[model samples]
Target: MHAFTVIRTYLRLGLLNFVQYRADFFLGVVNAAIQFAIQLLAISIVFNQTDSLKGWSRADLIVLVGVHAIVSGILGTVFSPSIGAFLESIRLGTFDFLLTKPVDAQLLASVQSVAPQSLTSLLAGIVIIVYGLQTGSGFPGFGSVVIFVGLLIAGLMMVYSFMMVLASLAFWFVKLDNIMNIFNTMFGNAGTWPITIFPGWLRVTLTFIIPIAFAVTIPAQALIGSLTLANALLTAALAVLFVAASRWFWLFAVKHYTGASA
Candidate 1:
């Protein structure tokens, strides 16, 4: 309960800070709009060439785009900013202050910063998802909606765990901006399509090594009605495993963290 309260307080402060800078919020909206437009144009051009890309219809692909936006929005809104701040703090030797807090260091570090402006993508993604559902496959039933939400949560969990593992690398490699860039490049370009379109070996790598396929593709399958019970089970299992492993890795990194004093 205390943790939840602290999270809420941090979120409120973040939102308040975002609103304080009206110009920044508008810039964020404009940036997000331009990016969203380009993605739509690309999707349209792809459909112009072929009716279906690897068995996924244009509408289905639209949902995939929305999923990507939503996932990206969430990352930007909280995790990305927080991770960036954490890394900066570590570099500046200010992370010692965070470690001294009564709360869990991981929890505090994860929610320390927020970018409410990034929510533009999240809201826009919802609009795109609704439009896609209207155009293709119709609306999923209540059960499917429940399942999709579950899978979406699972997808977010996997992505967060992956990022955390990467962030943990900062304990040794303090300058790791390139790592986040690599994830963004791969996820942004590849997550727009069905993972099935990839070659077998690459698919295995994305699903297990990088684990991005589980982040965007699997939950998308749930929404499009292609997700099977077995796949859902696998997603749940992997989510647990990723989270646990990331936590362990984080602790190991902390053990070696030699604070600002060092």
Candidate 2:
């Protein structure tokens, strides 16, 4: 069967799976609302103490929150579900079944899982972003919006690559689930503050080492008209490098799994 046929079949199955669990779908909305409220409360507290943090006003920070929420939602909806299943398959030895399939192993593993509930968080993020722009009166022009969106797409690609790298680690160290937990911990904390608030070394780590800064901060910076040309170019370069590295790592891991002694 063609790849497109496989994708359509899986997409239908995924949608059916979510429809069967409709209650969780509604709860997703409530959870997203609460999450937004918590973020806004934190922002309010910070603004009460200081008008700005690292040159970002409260509205700017709200945009940051939106960017974080949107990216988090996408991760939860797509990357987390697929990668979690990939890890589980490895542990249970079902990964061999996936490898035997005619379809692309990565594509099969990636599209097999879907969490429809995560759309709630995505919607809430857009709401927060719109509200921020309205209050701040800093609506971006057409070119700026296009740049912001491009940065966002680049950010998502960087994150997907990062997750793939982590998932590939499962082939070597099955016990590295703990490392994934740590990644999640860091990701959760990412939404709390702008990357600029971190120390210089930490900022460098976020930007280059992990690429989380690209996922959350750069898009927010674009929205606020603060993204620098150099930084944007650097983000694009990092995204390309990550994609190449992740593909290499996935292929290497597959070779190792096939009993080729690395």
Candidate 3:
């Protein structure tokens, strides 16, 4: 089958599987609500003690929080779960079936799992973003809007590539599961504050090494009309680089997998 056909089939099976557990849907809604409330309360507490945070006013920070929530929702919904399943497939040898298929391996891994529960987070994030836009001025005109969307797309791609690289490591180290827990912790914190709040060293790490800033902070900056031309260009360039690097790494990992299994 073609890649598109496989993707459609995978998505259908994922949806059906999620539908089998109906109660979990409501549970997911509750989880998203609690998460949103906690994030908003944290923002409120921070703003109460100070008028601004790291050059961001109350409204600006709220918008940042909203953007963070949206991004968090997206990551939890698709990138997180899909990659987790991919790693598991590798460990269990199910990945061999994927390698033998006609479609792209990464594409197959990515579209294989779609948790229905993540929809709750996605909806919550959209609501928060919309609320932030309504309250904050300077919503950005046409050019800025285009740039914001581009940055968001690039940001998502960068994050997925990074996660794929980590998942590919499972081919060599099955016990790497615990390490991904560390990634989850880092991901949770990345959306809580602007990268500017980090120390110089940490900021550099976030920007160039892990590139968390590209995933969350840079996109938030774009929304607030603060992203510089340099940052914008850098994000685009990094997105391209990460994609190529991830493909190369996955191919290398695939060779390792084949050799190990053989």
Candidate 4:
């Protein structure tokens, strides 16, 4: 309940900030629309050459695109902004204020900033997902839907954990802003496509090294009814493992930042 109140307060403040800078809202929408157009155009070009790419039809690919868009939206709206601010605060020597606060510093750092404008991508993703459902093999079964939602949540948790771990590195390296770009590049470039398209080694890298498969591919596969039980179990386990590891790492980083002993 306390966490909920704090999150609600942060969201309300974010909304007010958005209201104050309405131009950002328009720009964010325009940017998301342009990105969606580019993605759709790429999918069209790919489908023009062949009926399917690795057994995924045009509609199935669009669903994958939608899932990527939603993941991007969540990153933009929540993780990216918060982590960026946290890093900036560390560099500017303002993070001490947060450490001195009564709340959990990690939680505060992770949720203090919210970019409401990126929600446009989420809406666009939803529209694309719905369109794919209508044009594809119709709605998946209830069980598949349930599995998809569960995996989607797990995927998001994995992403948040990954970002938190990256952000925690700022305690040791304050100039690590470019490290965040690594995730952005991988997610924007490779995350939209099916993992099967890659070679066996690259598939393993994406699935375990960076875990983009859990972040986008696995959930999309669940929705499309092609997700294997083993992959699903792996994703769930990774999600839990990453979250716990991130939390522990955050505490360790904070201790180091404060000059605490082991």
Tell me the TM-score of each prediction against the true structure. 0.97, 0.94, 0.92, 0.94
- What does candidate 1's lDDT look like per residue over 1-262, in tens digits? 3899988989999999987887887888899889889998999999999999988999998988888888888989999899999999988999999988888999988999999998988888888888888999898888988888888888888888999999999999998999888987988788777888899999998888777778888888878888889989999999999999999999999999999889
Sorted on TM-score, best first, the list reads 1, 4, 2, 3
Could you give candidate 2's per-residue lDDT for residues 107-175 as a string of tens digits?
Answer: 787777878789788888888898888888568999988988898889888988888888998888875
Alpha-carbon runs more than 4 Å astray in model 1: none
Off by over 4 Å in 4: 259-262
| Candidate 4 structure quality by residue, lDDT tens digits, 1-262 | 3888888899899899999988998998899889888988999999999999999999998999998888888888877899899989988888988887888898899888999998888888888887877788787888998998899889888888888998899888888778898878987899889888999999998887677889888888887778899989988999999899999999998888953121
Order of the predicted models by lDDT, top scorer first: 1, 4, 2, 3
For candidate 2, give the lDDT of residue 195. Answer: 89
**For model 2, which pairs clash?**
none
On lDDT, the candidate that comes out on top is 1
Q: How well does candidate 2 score on lDDT at residue 158?
A: 90
Q: What are the lDDT figures for the candidates, one per model? A: 0.88, 0.85, 0.79, 0.87
The stretch of ten residues in a row with the least summed lDDT in candidate 3 is 253-262
In model 4, what lDDT does residue 193 have? Answer: 93
Give the poorly placed runs of model 3, Cα more than 4 Å off: 259-262
Deviation (Å) of 91 in candidate 3:
2.1
What would the per-residue lDDT of candidate 3 be over residues 1-262, giving only the tens digit for each residue?
6877876786688678778987888999898889778888888898789977788766676667666666666777667778888888877777778777778888878877777677787677667766776777656677876887798889888878888898889888876788888877887787567889889998998777676888778887887788899999999999999999999999898777763266
lDDT of 4: 0.87
